[model samples]
Target: MNVEGRTIEEDAVSAPPPDLSEWALHAFCLGARSSPHPVVAMDDNGRILYYAVGGIDMDRLMELGLKPNESQLALMKAYRLLTVEDGRLTTSFPVVGPQVMGELRRDIRAISADVTQSIRRDSEEMCAELARRGHAHHGYAVVFGHAVDGLVWEQLRDQLPSTKLSLERPFWNGAFWAIHPRRDDAAGVNEHPWSEGTLVSVWSARIAFELRSFLTESAVGRLTHNADGVLPVIHSDDSDELHRHGKLIAERLAEAILCDPRSKALSERIVGTHPGESLLIFAHELIWDLMDCLVEATPLVRPRALDNGSAPASDLRQLLFIRQ
Candidate 1:
């Protein structure tokens, strides 16, 4: 038999393709160099991504279980989508494996359905905890205490003209009752303890163990805070831990926003911060980040504005350093 020499029938000795892991990683890294958005590389593991926040709502602080030596960088996710064009790379969100991604996606769907109820439970607990402290804190983007809501892509772009995201209003938080998967479609949850919401607020929310960045920064001064139209989304290493304390904080904040008075006055602020549209953008960017981490292949990717047939969908998106 030619087995030892690696020869067999026409299709019998079809050895598997060379393990593309190394080259894949290299090519992907190079291609992804163009953009900085985290990506989800490809994986046979069936990873999952659960988007919790989008638009302008708070932050994207995902607690990957807690680590002691950790700085803010420890908790941040690195998943992102990649594109290679004209010998260059670009990125989307961060990346995750298929299993993780699937689990998160399903988990989020399940959570979203009963978000209002979940938030209420969280609120009660948060209030009790805050009471124990004798004083409560607040946030800035208080829409009746809803905390945060995403503006339309155009509106958000207008508000924060210096930011970039592959999709429209890409934010997710565990506190975000809006996008948490409602159905039983979620496959699993990670031991790391995932938090959902916009990446902005949470990334820098943690400052100290006893004292966190969220309580100090995102929290409104209640009667003392008053700002309109513009929302603050500052990024820093601290974002990764914003959810470590627990999802209860997010729930409490969301509930407060939904029922607050000063926030109710936001009739003409955001234009149209709907549900379905924003979620799609959130999911797309998140998923792309996952793929970015898992898969590795270089196809003459290119950068361009808008998704056009000009050079294939993926290539066009990767190269888009600027879009009108």
Candidate 2:
């Protein structure tokens, strides 16, 4: 029989069957790759969409008391993170399994430790200089403490190896709040915490503790209720009241860190077992404590004004509007 212009026997001899070696290699590569971590992504509007990972399903979510509405499912489908194939839910994304995650976590810890130490030392020096300049020391603790948290991420982010993981900084508002989600159980599906904005890391627990202290005890937070009317309706205004609020927040933060059991346990664990996990938390507390000690040891002098300029109130208000 003839096939196209060539006889069947001629075509067979010329093109022979392609070997399976290349196909076998491709299959092996796919099998050897690590699986991606299952995570839920949240948009600015607070809507969350899940990235399907193995063993997580609607039944599991229901068992855990979670009820994702139809709108959420529709949003997930829109983002292509969810799909129905043959009446089965399926999704695809890059993966890094538990073992790879552990290794990456270790690397992150090591780099974060070095960066945090350097920042702490710099913060201490800056506080000392401020004290020498006869600036009021009351607000330096919270200022430097919060600054250290941001600096740690800024410095460590570039040093760590890239992965598909999401690393978010502790949430903070310019005027008052510093928010963080509590840690979830390590072995569970983690949909609950994921929904609540918790990242997968031991450091998240530390961030939660630190932010909770600020939220509850800081003078700038809701506890003070507009700094007892000293602050303007616009919280971020650059006024004397804002400075006073900052000073009060610093003083309250210092006291809170020393008295909070969570902070104490973290400090104790720094010299106890698993120091690596507690290093950042301990460093954070130590920075605040050291600043407080510096304020107490040095005599207070007349304070000079520092630059506290910020975005215009109108511009800041625009952030509240949701962009379509």
Candidate 3:
């Protein structure tokens, strides 16, 4: 967790060996969004049980090169610079473990409000679009871990008076809610997961939302009860070497974004000037927190078991558990 990172200056002299830990962390965070194929976490039975969720089609967009519009270009550049490879596994070890949790926990706690606001913007836009179609008046979900509760929502509602909050569930572990603009006529709480928060408020709201979307929306897979979480093996051979080269390339690009004046200017144009460097740093931090959260969650066996079984078994459970 505390591995020494290659300095930006070192990047200029010569590329260093791939930091497998760093690469794994990046893959854990951004694999779904950036890769063409599914990025899965493996269970003890060698079954791929968890799939990452992604909003954009990076490979398709990346292929557009200079053909995309300005906004698309900016987003593509950000994705290219920030994420590792799409379909490949980058580390030799399972990302989940107690040995690395301390570092991850600290990183999670440091997520910022700016990042939360950015994430909220995306969710709100989606909700607004849904409303336009008359599909639903409003939809709300929160991104949170087991340790967080509705208090976070309460505080956020207090802060953003434009939005109203109503709890659909009273439980602390996974509180669901319905939220919308105070002036909007949306009503009723329904089954959904649009709320967002992080444990100890350590992870940013944006990353938390992204992770929540992945866990709830993607194909459901179970974590093996006994194994340390396993990362998918996309390639039996040359994966480690490919990862090293990829890591080197990614680091150099990140460094160039910070160091080269031309690259810096391009980033400013793409990302805007208000918070500037702070915003970029926040993005970086959010990605790291995301990786940490994914790894931490992948080994838990209980969440994997919650999927409603196939139709026949679904009714059987109701019949078995309830008296006539």
TM-score of 2: 0.28
Error of 1 at 126 (Å): 1.3
Candidate 1 wrongly placed segments (more than 4 Å): 1-82, 85-113, 138-324
How well is each residue in 1-324 modelled by candidate 3, as lDDT tens digits? 111232323443342222221121221121122321112211110111101111224343334231234453333223322122553211211222222333433443434222333334333443344345432211221122110111222222222212122242111111111111111111111112222211111122223333334334331232111023221111112243322322332333333334445433333332212333322332333333432342243221112112222223222111110000
Best by TM-score: 2
Using all chains and alpha carbons, the TM-scores for the candidates as numbered come to 0.19, 0.28, 0.21
Residue 311 of model 2, lDDT score: 34
Candidate 1 per-residue lDDT over residues 1-324, each given as its tens digit = 121122223352343112112111211111122322222223311111222111111122123222222221222232222222342222223222222334454444333334434333333333344335332221211111121122112222322223233343233211111111121211110011113223222110111121222223343232113233123221212232212112343434334334443323321122223332233323332222222221122111112211222333222212111000
What lDDT does the true structure give each of the candidates? Answer: 0.24, 0.30, 0.25
| Number of the candidate with higher lDDT, 1 or 3 | 3
Instruction: Itemize residue pairs with steric clashes in candidate 2.
Output: 35-95, 35-96, 36-95, 36-96
Better of 1 and 2 by TM-score: 2
Model 3's lDDT to the true fold? 0.25
For candidate 1, the per-residue lDDT at 193 reads: 13
Cα RMSD, each candidate: 22.8, 21.6, 22.3
- Across 117-174, the per-residue lDDT of candidate 2 in tens digits comes to 3334444444444445333242232233223322232333332223332222112101
What is the Cα-based lDDT of residue 167 in candidate 3?
48
